[model samples]
Target chain A: MTGAPMPRLPTGIAWLDRLTHGGIPARRLTVLLGQAGAGKTLLSCQIAAARARVEGAGTVFAALEEPPADIIRNAAGFTWDLAALAGEHFHPLDLRPDPDMVFAGDFDLRGMLATLSAKARQTGAGLVVLDGLDTVLGWLASPARRSAELARIGRWLEEEGLTAIVTAKAERHGGPADALGPLEFAVSLVVALERREESGGTLRALRITKSRGSAHSSSAHPLFFSHNGLEPLMWPGGDAPPASQERVGSGMARLDALLGGGYLRGSTALLSGPPGTGKSTLAALFAASICAGGGRAVHVAFDEGPEQSIRNMRSVGIDLAAHRASGALRLIGLQPGRDGPEQLLSEILAAVETQDATALVVDPVSSLMRGGVADLGQSAVRRLVEEARARGMTAVLTSLVEIGEDPASGTLSAVSTIADAWIALGYAERGGERNRTLSIVKARGSAHSNQTREFVMSSEGCTLADVYTAGGAVLLGTARMEREAEERRLETLAALDHQRRLRALEAQLTEAELRQRRSALESEAARAELALLEAAEAERRAAQAERQARTAASRSADTPAEEGASA
Target chain B: MSAAAVALFVAGGAPRSAAALRNLTAAIAATGRPEGTFRVEVIDVLREPGRALEAGLLATPSLALTAPHGRRRWFVGEFDQPELLAGWLGDVLDGEPP
Candidate 1:
């Protein structure tokens, strides 16, 4: 009766706890919600039995929908000892079929709540479970009466120091507005259980629809229920060792330098830039780089075929087939319509694990989400990237940014936060000449050149020229670049001519200063001699006066008061 | 040939119950493969009245797979492929192939 607030324990379910802060914040009517088959009664019963098992409370579960015996049988399937727990300390009251004395006509909200409270007080129970809200809501004839009943029940449940779970069957086929019943506003927590038929089995998605005073799990989490009860399916999101393998160079030396010895063994990078900027080419080359480095790499082509990818990379001289033939690179060309987000993930995971790949290239993840993969939103790509990070494999992601916009200002719209680095390849036009500019927008854990460098791709190879710095700013185009070349030539010639001019000026200034100082010294020396003569006379006179003043002072001190007056 | 398929190939004489369909030697000798030319799934309206209505079947012998495709008319008279007709199905299915 007198301990700290029961630790408000996390019912071991993170999402549920997030909704009610800590396990329903004891002594409150925590209504369980859902449509008819929302597993509302199951949720409440689980809480009741869990409370008894965990906190050793005298728990009571009253079933209104089923016969008490049938309810007990169902609970037995879950192997929860409702009667046993009741035998030790708890008591389960089953009010089914109603009493002969009280007719349906006399039943009302006030009467029902009075009976509920009386039962709670009699049992000294802290948790109360109500099976269905419709029977109770029927007591109210109108909307105003319904709201009043809800408000009264909510307030009474709070005052009784009882955390009651009242479930109402919501209308789900309608919109969310219509799906939410009365308790959506009255209850402290609302967990909407969504179970739809998946391919093989049912997929259960638990969403915390509302929580009055807590941080609920907002994401619709995959749920699992077995004989042991309910739980949320946790993705690979816990603590794991960071990928420590050395990165294989992307075959572009300067690019490698910008990438801090290239991408780490298991890291996902997003290649975002305008179309025709070689995002796919760069991605293929990175994959080829991984195979060249002696580890397996899989190139999942969601948009382009192997031939297109290879031909595109050929511009930069990255031969994918040579590496593929060497038993290093595996290219899985995915027909855009075949798989979904989850399916692609499963396939990718299977391929990487089977291939034991050190790197993976998902060409243009934007296309994969926009058109290729079903069942994945923009956020789903983030989850995939997160999964890749957990596996410690390098995943190279590429995105096509629209042209004519400053890529420097553009963010990787598809899952950029988890990107350890972004290698932005863009095109800039200046003086009617279009040029290719490659810049490392952001590279985590590495120092990179800030200047937008010009890169030329040809049959020879992909190469990055000297960094382009132009006209009081960093330029990435050809016009200012040409102007800079001409200006450099002019500056070189001007520097040589200035050297000659400086030498001639130094000779003239040196001779002029020496001759001028000699003439001034002669004129100033005579004036110095005259000034010294006057100064010598003044010094002798001042010394004599100082000697006299000292003597007068000493004689005055010797005379004291009367002697000083006589002096 | 196995006794089951051999029995299925013979002619039948009378009406039979579905529970006895598993004992092919006696069931097929009495009643040939289901007589429903359109659909061939048996219905025992007496015992499984619920299931019969659910599956939309009549209270008699039924043949489920029946129809025409291209130039070939697949006269699927039996519940399974026939032993004598196996030769027409090709080398893949040898005499009511196992």
Candidate 2:
């Protein structure tokens, strides 16, 4: 088989296809191993349905364990339309042995192979599914014989150029052995589906244990089974289109500032919050913004009916009626338990395509967990977000975090990891009032605000108030108002005190000026008095000198004796 | 020796099958049985390849014997091991009347 071109068939599940590197090898025996209720039957049925419907290949599904009716019913639950599939050349064969023939002389692999070959020939089937091969193995005597027979069956199918899929139980004891008998070595590919318990609910996982002649993912990926069928819960990584360096509004300018000019175009944002914290309102605002900008949007209302959702949004002054009427917005309402998660996702995707949506909002994605398959909900949300991003659409998903639950490890944590931005909304109880707060937990590719802003849902739509932190606590609503009022009061008191000090300083300056003026007047008066005294003294001295001059004259007349005294 | 049945198969146009057929014929002749005591049938799988599966033959120059005493044995390989083939045939016919 070396150097020969290997052909592969798609299993129709996106993540599974990616895991198997396009799909299981064509024209080869593939073994599907799983425990009871691990979804092997459903997976096999999905493959057969895919080959028949998608590839236009004739498929013959031979049911060995479950009755054909049950298989058909299950397929119907996924909306596969098995009857229509049969009309289009898909055949379902009941290969279970008759009760009388169970103890008959002989019933072996040869007989089963011959029957299968005949059926394939009659239906011109290119693909064959042997469901419950372990059930057929039970009729055989020994493991060695079963292995040999399986090897022969593999050869026969190869010789006929028919692709074969066989399902075997992976039980430990009392039932089918874990050893897949010869199928483990005989088949070209081996896939396993498993389920385990988690904190939320059961987590289904799918793994490709063996794929000969092709590379495949070896890690166990979460598996989801819903109305669409079985699929790996992992996002198919590259299905989205290329991203553009475009930015869209998040409806609120302050929120946009918090999100670094709003979420990137073709990016996903996760809004996690407690119930009644305006998560849906934020999503509605995001969607309405896109629609108002003349772009299409899809709003998947999980918690409320369409009318109620529209009414609720309208209450916040987000009128979606115009956009809905103009075909710019699509509102899809799904009752959680009525339709499975996969169905809801598909419908949303369909609406996205139909509306050519540039934005998508799944209001309260937590409702996707209603079916109790935790991994399914997680995977579905992840896929929705990724797909929307890939198509260059902004996707905003909301999740309701319960009170007292850590938002970091809540039900939405797994989904939050893939979001381009995570906006955590919650209520702050301050000043005996409850108000919503919005905080950016993480935003990739942008510098976003770290402060928690007060998220207000008003008649004019949702808006973010200025960040308010008081006493080392982020406050909201009445607490924020109270803090602001207190700040203003303090500022007013400081201003009043500053004015009083200025007046006191001014009075002291006035007092000092008065004292300086008085001292100058006193000094001027003293100088004036001294000058007057000096003047009088000068006049006296002059009078005295004149009088002395007269005396000296007289004395000079009597001079001789007076001159000696004057000298 | 009692009557024994043997068959030799060779692909019609294969060089190895022709050489193997010649070696197998010589080994059968060396079995030392009288002409009428044993019968050797030659089948060309190319001309009648469907018969190969019926005879449980998987390759060219395969030989099988149905001994008169109800023993069945099959030998498969290249004609390069003709002596081993002859020895096996001798043991199969050892107790048969001649």
Two-chain DockQ for each candidate model:
0.01, 0.02
After superposing candidate 2, which stretches have Cα over 4 Å from the reference?
A1-6, A102-115, A173-180, A195-202, A214-218, A236-243, A252-261, A272-278, A293-296, A301-304, A325-358, A366-383, A399-416, A424-441, A447-567, B1-98
* Tens-digit lDDT track of model 2 for A387-440: 777688898989888898876685677878878889999888867789888889
In model 1, where do residues sit more than 4 Å from their true spots? A1-194, A197-219, A222-240, A243-248, A371-375, A404-411, A480-567, B1-98
* Residue A229 alpha-carbon offset, candidate 2, angstroms: 0.5
lDDT, residue A5, model 1: 44
Model 1 chain A worst lDDT window (10 residues): A99-108
Candidate 1 docks at the CAPRI level of incorrect
Model 1, range A24-88, lDDT digits (tens) per residue?
65655555556665566766667667767777665546565566566555667564676566645
Q: TM-score, each model?
A: 0.43, 0.61
Pick by DockQ: which candidate is best?
2
Q: Give the TM-score of candidate 1.
A: 0.43
TM-score for chain A, candidates 1 onward in order: 0.49, 0.69
